[model samples]
Target: MAQSVLHRDPRVDFFRGAAFIIILIAHIPSNWVAQWIPARFGFSDATEMFVFMSGFAAGIAFGGTYRTAGFWLGTARIYFRAWQVYVANLLLFFFVLVLMLAANAWLYADTDYVTQLALNYFLDDTGRALLGLFSMTYVPNFFDILPMYIVVLLMVPVFMALSRIHPLAGYAGCLVLYAANYVFIFELPAEVSPDRDFRAWFFNPFAWQLLFFTGFAMSMGYLKLPRFRWWLAALCLALIAVGVVYSRYGLWSWSDTLSDLRGQLVDLRCQNWRGDGADRCYFWTKSNLDVVRILHFLAIAYLVVWALKGRERVLTMGWAQPILQCGRQSLPVFMFSMILSRVYNVLMDQTERTTWEEIAFNVVAVANLIAIAYLLGWLKSNPWRPHKPARTPAPEAQGQAQGGARWGNAVPAPGSAE
Candidate 1:
């Protein structure tokens, strides 16, 4: 019998949506409401979850695409998608840059607008415009992930080729790269300049590639490691325990002997810290592979998969569908959410409240996010129902293309399907 795969994994969608929520909460300026939940619970940094899922989703999306479309066509599709992301990012950069300039001029007339403009050079129209067009590293902006995505897309051909020939060797290559990254790249001093002077150190593709390639390998059944659902549960518990210990008593030090050795090897400053054994708990938060974090996330992810197996109804209930929809079209949703977040930040800055009001602010923020998400969902469902332009296709089309024919067919056609 042919092996089966899930077209829409509720667990993945729920976790992805939850990740976005956490990211939103984290970005909310410190308020009493936000602080009520302890940061250690994983609310402080949701970026790791997002990035990891991005890789995981990439595996599910592109790996399937490669199988169906074959290597060359699959590579082209990925490149096109990456290029679309880059283009969208570029447009956003210019839009934000212009707004920032106008705000500086009109809003901060008394202050040194020129100085402010210069300081935000990367956020300026010309700088962002250049970065977007060329995919060059011009600024230390969080939005620069577009370039990284593009670079990773470029690697798809190589990854695909290796996967076709020897999936184990391909995955092993990814593992070796990850190991080298951990020992040499990640261990290097924080300030070590990449050849591009682009803080490639911070955005270490080598390390992140492991997550992406692992997803790819899994999709291809290259690494036939036993699927230990129960062990995954244990791993999750262990990670929680480690996180709790680290948060409570782990000491953070950047001057340890290990740091010195690492710093010397890489010719950069080293930050070494002693965690209460739990301090270094969340690997995703590190944005680099920490063995503990990697193992923990893997465990949690597998457990989630096991739990959600054959449970489709759980994903179809009440608000769950919309959230899953958001997860399905994650890239666009992410881009849209980022734009909304930046707008929210600007609005919050304008308000300038000193006190953190948790209940009130969170209530408003959550409501707005959900409302926006719902609106986006509605648009997705009914893109051409007379009011909206038929020009832009529903985000579901994008997901379908990535997932292949079966899943693609599941998406209701514009008017009749939903």
Candidate 2:
């Protein structure tokens, strides 16, 4: 009898789709009606979730490749993908620059010629072009992730080599790097001006690699220990409760008893601490990992995974399928979405920034995103291409059977070897 190829994990698709929805919805300005579910609960910042999941997905997709093809191949693949992203980003950057120039010319025709030229040259093209590529000093404009993605690609080989030793060891290294980021790098001198160091190190690929490693480690059976799921659920619930309490009651507020407790728990001085300072605020937003943020993100991730169990029918529904399709080809979808979002932002005037209008805009954005994803999926599943079975070596095949037995093949494995 021939073996059948198992289904790929729907959890990844569902989560990625959910992340897109969160990203879109979170960007909309909150209205009276929108306050029912706090944006913070859904997703206050979409970048972290996207980056973390990207790492996780890469781990699952690329780990076996690293094992079989060795580190160089794995590194090459990641770098190639990174290069693709960089090229796409550059294209978008130039496109946006041209659009900005045109918009300024048409909209601000009444302005003085010199003023218009300066605005076009300094603000529209030159400043933004520099900001987009290096992402060094300017505010984190759209498409900044391209540079960060390039950095992460460079580190993939290092991560692949480390992962082979022990998944936990790789995770430990990521954690140590994250901790160093908070202690040594995040804090800036109170008197000194903030510049590239503030933005670059805060968004440092080295520090943020922890979230990606966490995802990768989990996919590789690092979290497969007995009772681990239950423990994670419990921990997640507890942290959520704490987060709720912290949100409700200003834990760091000047109330007498609470202030004292907050002082003891977190050094207020840490906020002002520069290079040599030990005052570390637990909630500081660095591109690096913060303990609170990590826990918060993990709790949400666990909840999503737990909710996804035995829910394939729900995920495969009419509307749901489109999101899943987008999730399937996430990289292309992400790049496309970024381009569309930038274009939308540029075309819309300040009048469209109204709360209700923003909400409607997001709804349309998500709908179009889903449509794009579905179209891509349809294109990929071309009826013209006949399906073929993959060949496997006899010894390697036997090893798989034994390994499956060891793992107790309750869950169906995906069709691809990786």
Candidate 3:
């Protein structure tokens, strides 16, 4: 994909970091904070934001590799990053298992919530479950996102190659596969527990890939993110308002009895087929990348991009730097947060906490997440990567170096090596 150039963009980081935080809040079951996330107002939630930002970052990072080196090098870098994500997933799997087992042992040591948290397989059939975990077939309820990412990263080379030739062609392929998946219900295998049939992957890479590339392509300059328009924003917000009401009610099933005007809510049935309910309304489902979810996310992203256009500088301000730092170190922050959030989950479960206690727990967890981000940011400095080669020597030095041995009209002055 061809973005104008590789350069730091705080807007991306700012939102990326914000997405991680949103994911954390949402993942924590029963956390009141979850209600305020974008999902409450629209069909799409933090996951789209996370994946879009992932693709956006990837386009910038690997696009540079493709440009500086060549297609093969760029492809290799894509695989390498995929390998890293896979490794992180593996590490996370073990971490989750250990945390669950430890929590079980300490609390009650009697009844088990580890299974409640979806680790029954590990306890019942350790060997097969271990195999499934390694194969990425047995994803815990909350740990499936990484596997989706692993699949996406593995496909980046194909996206890059296609986009390099024709951006539309690449996205065309993604669109075809996504549509086919919806048509055929194509899915990667997943077995959360032995009792149930192997279920399809929750996120459906075949579908989510469309969103991923939409972001990558947008970032790569293949597709321009539409400039914010008042009509569009208002429409989006109006539809969002309808969604909010639907959420507040029971999908508007009760609206008919409300004795009030909720007619526009009916328009949400965008896929209504003749008189069929779906034809008239848009359904929002994450697995199939439903039109409602897709448009909701696009609208949200457009608003963010437009609103933050000239305000990028604020992300770096002291007040905003925590988010900026976390965004810059998204992967590590993400991994850390998942683990931390689980720990909080166990704590929430093991104790009878009051509302104040829950709020305090969330606050402390967020602070800890920020501190981890800070540490990750610091550790990422230089030592984690090989030192860059020094800049080319000056022309006069190059000439002298070519002369070798003794310098012109000069001899080795001391015992020190020349």
| Candidate topping lDDT | 3
Off by over 4 Å in 3: 1-7, 108-111, 192-195, 248-284, 382-418
Worst 10 residues of 1 by lDDT: 409-418
Please provide, for model 2 over 1-418, each residue's C-alpha lDDT reduced to its tens digit, 9 standing for 90 to 100: 0152134445566557666665544433233223433334422245667777676566655654555566787677767777777777667656655665666566533323224222233354564536534443332334356566666666777766776787666677777877776656643211112332333433566666777667666655554423337777888788776565445336437468756865665564346655455445533544455556676877766676556545655766786777677678776677667655544453334444676765666667778888888887778778578877755433223323322222223212331222
What candidate 1 gets wrong by more than 4 Å, as runs, is 1-7, 29-39, 42-45, 105-119, 123-133, 183-198, 224-226, 229-232, 248-287, 310-312, 350-359, 380-418
Q: Over all chains combined, what TM-score does candidate 2 have?
A: 0.73
lDDT of candidate model 3 versus the reference: 0.69
Error of 2 at 416 (Å): 9.5
Question: Per-residue lDDT of 213-311 in model 1, one digit per residue for the tens?
Answer: 665455345554345556657867776654544442332133476445534633321233332443332223355655555565665556655565556
The residue-level lDDT of candidate 3 at 242 comes to 61
As for TM-score, the candidate ahead, 1 or 3, is 3
Per-residue lDDT over 174-280 for candidate 3, one digit per residue giving the tens place of the 0 to 100 score: 88887676555666777846588877777778888888888767655667666568998898777676666656434656657532454554444443444543322
Top candidate (TM-score): 3
> What does the lDDT read for residue 304 in candidate 2?
62
Per-model TM-score, in order, reads 0.70, 0.73, 0.82
lDDT of each: 0.53, 0.55, 0.69
